[model samples]
Target: MIKRLICAAVFSGTIATNVNAEELRFTVWTGSKAHLDMLNDIANGFKQTHPDVTVRYDTIPFGDYVQKLTLQMAGGNPPDLGWLLENSAPAFVEAGALADVSKTLHATENYNYADFSTSAMGLWTKDDSVYGIPFSTSPFLVYYNKSLYDAAGLETPDQRATDGTWTWEQLKKDAATLRNADAGVWGYETVDGQGYSARVWHNLIPIIRAYGGNAWTDGTCHLDSPEAVKAIKLFHNMIYVDGSAVPPGEQGDFFSGKSALTVTQISRVSKLADANFDWGIAPLPAGPAGNAATVGQAAVVAFAQGKNKEIAAEFLAYMTSAKNVAKMAEFFPPARKSVLEGDAFLSSNPAITPAQMKIVAQGIENGSVLPSHEHFPQIEAKARPEFDALWSKDADIQATMTKLCQGIQPLL
Candidate 1:
């Protein structure tokens, strides 16, 4: 009776009634009031079809997320649905921790499952089974301080992106020109200041990819390739030679106006909402191989251990439908091709204009998700000390990369 009612309501796009009530627990890492508010709105909308169902969102700090979630699953108290990072996807899917939602997704009426991009869906799928749905397929972009650019008497990234001169070399020159020792302002900040450690891969992949270097291909390591070494050398020069990037221990926040540029996703735009200076978003600088856009993705998954697995998958389908994905484009960039190319997504956020949003759309159309492996955590642990070795003034770029690759190749 419940299944028939759900199918009927979903097909008719109307409300269904049930005397028995159920609540789903969904875990996520974001604690932002705005993000929660938007999420709550979506959750409430789900009651239109499943009138007796309720969704409760649990917030976990990012650093402790995977650990706590693993504990919950081990303790036999896993969330019905949860948001899983790209790096964790392979591990979770391999362990059979996630429920297969392909049947539920395909069974939902008017779902238009094909609207999601193939690249965006790559991580959650394995042959005949689908374990999750990507919720955020955000791309790396250059966020520039337009006010600082104007004060420095230099063109901003957006202007250069328009003129076809926004290459990595040009960015390096701009960073050098904008460095202001007297005011204590830095030229560039990498991926939220954790680039050298926690976000080391995110810090290097775009630059490496733009230079035609890849982390690995078909089980072979390429971090020591000539293209990769050159890319690392350029960044190394920026830190020690140019003294432009905020170094390993230093503090410089682009959103706080202490840095002139940053590489981040559209979600960070909320940080600039009340900024004291003008800002704009632009595509990542190009390289010899042209621009190689990189994306960071997160997916919504149902746990295999959940008591409410079927209903959880139904709600997942509801939340990620084309209409809701369009609504979510304001904060979480959508993976749906229909929403991404639509005019509504361009104007979804009041803080960003349509023109600026187009850069994000183009990036989604071309970008590849950041590197992920089943052994990512082990690889990150083994590669940390090697990465730390390269932060010094006279670190040998070629030798360090060669050593780093040797250590991680086995883990891969």
Candidate 2:
């Protein structure tokens, strides 16, 4: 009997050691307050079911996230798990710093790949393999001050949500109606120029795609095509010819109620909730090709050097589960269709309407993921000066785009 007790004690000690070995470290660059709170909740939830495993989370600011992540990867000490933006994933994937998470994600029963937007999935896939599970997925929407619109005797933008009739032409007309210099208000405000060139690119890409133009073709820059040139010309016209959108330097006016309409990400709803005026959101105005699209932000990935890959993947699975994803929607929309369509997810935020959510869902489903090549950063760098010139109405569209493409081609 004494010998049996000794054997049982040794077995118990072995189990304890095994359990203690199952710890994971995850790094996320999400800096939003609501997102961080939801992440903590998910972590705590994981700990409940996974008593043997411990998860440690580290936060990084958005500005330094990529640079810091790159440095850590170069030093061969990347976190067990990290957040990867769609625009930045290709570069890291090319460096072989990310694990091919396809198999692990596929093995999980509740982890449904089909439920995520194709564009969201496209961001983390190279060739035929997927590297990450999508997290926050957003699409551009029109946020308008209802008081401003009503005071101007204008119809609410939400009226056009179902028919996709909110065109650039209509938006311009509405902007003209709302402009009032004496009251410090304008019809529309958008972030443009080199300082916020990505914002211009984000809004413009949908228009380009809607007009049947590909931003890049066969791994080469194709922004100089007839359709693309027309798209750029129209965008330029909005600021220069239409007198509807505020100039680049005047973006702050919109946040201060100087503009009636602002094109922004759905994630900004939280920020706008406390504004002095009543606000409403509508789907992005449709373009010529009878479709709409928007740029997506970031997803979650696993590092190649992670010691606890299995546990890391499990944690990711748990975090992205429908229940957990519903919690995350308090900050940003979850990537899963199941979560997006569920009553729990929809009922959490009464501020966002079901119609608006449908528009976002459709936009994400139809959206194109931004292409990420090795020289993408370089391409963006070279293109910005010309885009700035275009916005300032000083550059010839054809000549500028042609030159920009030439500079980007060599990088590709």
- Which lDDT values do the candidates have, in the order given? 0.85, 0.69
Give every collision pair in model 2. none
Looking at candidate 2, what is the lDDT of residue 113?
67
Alpha-carbon runs more than 4 Å astray in model 2? 1-30, 50-64, 75-77, 106-120, 126-129, 191-195, 241-243, 253-256, 295-297, 306-310
| CA RMSD per model (angstroms) | 7.3, 9.8
Report the C-alpha lDDT of model 2 over 333-407, residue by residue, as the tens digit: 777878877767655666677666776666666665655665455666677787777767565988888887887
lDDT per residue as tens, model 1, 135-250: 88999999999999999889889899899999888888988888888998899999977789767888999999999999988877899999999999999999999999999999
Poorest stretch of ten by lDDT in candidate 1: 1-10
Model 1 per-residue lDDT at 304: 79
Give me the candidate number with maximum lDDT: 1
Assess candidate 2 and give its TM-score to the true structure. 0.81
RMSD (Cα, Å) of model 2: 9.8
